[model samples]
Target: MRIDLTSVFVDDQAKALDFYTDVLGFEKKNDVPVGDARWLTVVSPEAPEGPELLLEPSGHPAVGPYKEALVADGIPAAAFSVDDVHAEYERLRAHGVRFTQPPIDAGSVTTAVLDDTCGNLIQIMRVA
Candidate 1:
């Protein structure tokens, strides 16, 4: 009935942690050690009790190919809502974020895609 947590496969957990928190501004929620990988999760600062994003490791056999295919096709692994797509894009760009696609209107919304640098493309969008 409701979403609690979601995940995106990451090539490296440490780098993803820095980017998701230091750059994108998400707050760290959990960091439990799970064998070789940690059960790391982050939550939006605006809604600390909202759904959490799990930065899962891409060590599984199928994950590498799946991520590669998605990137090759210019697809975003996750989409985050923003107040202003263009403004967010600009702000992120200034912080050295590399966007695969700049903000563009698409019918009812505007979106921009940026590489997460940990092997995933993420999209920031605003409803128009």
Candidate 2:
């Protein structure tokens, strides 16, 4: 079997949508109202029919602590593949994206980490 979808817990769905779409350049795939939250998802514009990243609401009590711990430890919640890590880093930085870690060559790949502003750290990487 193949992967279908993955998720990133977000503090605010609206802000997450703006960042993931307007900033990160992902395209909205689904947005269905589910009680107090929405079943929102985004997909890479380059791969519209591929795996979708769910912009999950962090309403559950456990999510806050989990996200905090991850951030405290400098761990990324999700990683996105890019054509050039350094280029993407510069572009994002120009758009006011605050990166926790600058792009660094990690043997076979280069990566950088940025705060998503919705309470998560996201990584962008490229094969070196």
Candidate 3:
């Protein structure tokens, strides 16, 4: 068995696209309209054919509370692997991204958490 796709609930698809692509460096893979929302997904540039991250609409009632609770508890909505967690964190900070947690060495890995601005916290990590 293999993973094909996963999703992160987003308040706005357009803003999510910009942040995921322009800021986080993911590439848009698919964008098909579906009713009031679109089937928007992105893939890492390094792995165009790999698993896709779906930017799902957060119109559902449960989403708001779920996201709020996660943020309140400092939980990341998604985690992305990077070659260098510190470098990625610095680059993101320069772009005005607000981080909830700075890069910290955590035994086998290093990680930092940043707010996605569209109502989610995302983690960038590197395995040692």
State the lDDT of candidate 2 residue by residue for 10-124, as single tens digits: 9999999999999999999999999999999999989899999999999899999999999999999999999999999999999999999999998999999999999999999
Lowest lDDT 10-residue stretch of candidate 3: 84-93
- The per-model lDDT (C-alpha) reads 0.97, 0.96, 0.96
**Cα lDDT of model 3 by residue, 11-102, tens digit:** 99999999999999999999999999999999999999999999999999999999999999999999999999999988999999999999
Q: After superposition on all CA atoms, what RMSD does each candidate show versus the true structure? A: 0.7, 0.6, 0.6
Off by over 4 Å in 2: none
Q: TM-score for all predictions?
A: 0.98, 0.98, 0.98
| Cand. 2 Cα-lDDT | 0.96
Error of 3 at 34 (Å): 0.3
How do these models rank on lDDT, best leading?
Answer: 1, 3, 2
